[model samples]
Each structure stands twice: as structure tokens, then as C-alpha cells.
Target: MTYIWTGKRWAYLAMVIDLYARKPVGWATSLSPNSELTSNALKMAYESRGRPEGVMFHSDQGSHYTSHK
Candidate 1:
């Protein structure tokens, strides 16, 4: 949890992990998660881990990755 003091209370965080090496390449802490947070995690993962040219990325039925926005 990020403990985001949202003017009223603490908050939580949603995280994204890469199964490739069993590590969190990206994560986001927010009052709540949206597509943006997911995308940031993905971006961080790519940057931190050096985006493989054709590596396959997999995720569940999360709309964030599916939305393609």
C-alpha cells in the first residue's frame, strides 16, 4: 500500500508484474488504479528491463492492457 493521504484517508496500490523473471518491472500506487497506472507500470518495465524486441507479454482479462488506448 502507498498510504496516499487523499485528503481524508490512506489509499492502496495496484501492481503489475512480469512473469518472465518473477519480478515487478513496474507498479503504481494510487487512490485507485486506472489504465494510466497500468500503462505507467508497463512503460517502467520496458525501460527498466530493456524492452525485448519481440518478447511476449501476457496478462489476465484486465481491460487496461486490452483497451489499447
Candidate 2:
């Protein structure tokens, strides 16, 4: 997760990168750095990747990533 100065308020961005491609496969931005922001990025990556089976995900265990929401 990272933040950007929008010249007024801060904006947060979440991204999911494909290890194989070494590039971002999904990304999302929001005004709030919360579970929803991370969820949105994961959801996009899952769907865009055809919802493959037996995939494992790793994270830095940040609160947003570990949230129940």
C-alpha cells in the first residue's frame, strides 16, 4: 500500500502484482486505506485472472489485508 498527495487530501493505492509477469495485474485507489481498498484490488485480480484455482496469496500482514471486512 502507498499514498499519494492529491494536492489537497491523501489518496491510497493498492496493487496486486503477478510474480511471473513482474507487473501489476490489478490495482485500486481510494481515499481511505481500509480493507475495502485491498479487497477491490484482489477482486479485480482474481476475476481478471479467470478465477484460477489453487492459488496462494501472500501479504505483508497489514491491517487492511488481515481485516475481516
Candidate 3:
């Protein structure tokens, strides 16, 4: 999770990167960092990548990632 300054206020930015391409595949912003934020970014990446199977995910061990949500 990263905090971005939007000139007026701070926002949370979540991103999914394509390691092979070293580029961002998907991203999402929210006022708060939560499961929904990361989930949405992953969802976008999944859809963009044609929904590949047997994919693995990694995270920074944040509560949002560990949460049941």
C-alpha cells in the first residue's frame, strides 16, 4: 500500500505488476487501503490477462491481504 498526495488530500494506491514486463498491469485508488482496494486491482489484472489459471499472488503481509474479506 502507498499513500499518494492528490493535492487536496491523501489517497491509497494499490497496484498489480507484471514481473516479466516490469510494468504495472493494474491499479486502483481509494481513500482507505483495504481488501476491496487490493482485490479490485487484482481483479482488474486477472481480467486484463484473460483470467489465467494456477496463478499465484504475493503481498506485503498487510492485514488487508490477510483478512478473510
Compared with the true structure, what per-residue lDDT tens digits does model 3 show for residues 1-69? Answer: 789999998999899998887888888999988899988898899998899999888887888778887
| Model 1 lDDT on a 0 to 1 scale | 0.68
List ranges where model 1 is wrong by over 4 Å: 1-12
- Tell me each candidate's TM-score: 0.68, 0.95, 0.88
Query: Which digits, one per residue and each the tens of the lDDT, describe model 1 over residues 1-69?
Result: 234667897665555577867877777766665777667767777788777688677777677667766
Encode model 2's per-residue lDDT on 1-69: one tens digit a residue. Answer: 999999999999999999987989889999999999999999999998999999988899999999998
Better structure of 2 and 3 per lDDT: 2
On a 0 to 100 scale, what is the lDDT of residue 65 in model 1? 69
Clashing pairs in 1: none
How much does candidate 3 score in TM-score?
Answer: 0.88
Alpha-carbon deviation at 25 in model 2, angstroms: 0.9
Highest lDDT model number: 2
User: Candidate 2 — worst ten consecutive residues by lDDT sum?
Assistant: 18-27
Local lDDT at 50 for model 1: 75
Residue 9: error of model 1 in Å? 5.4
What does each candidate score in C-alpha RMSD? Answer: 3.5, 0.7, 1.1
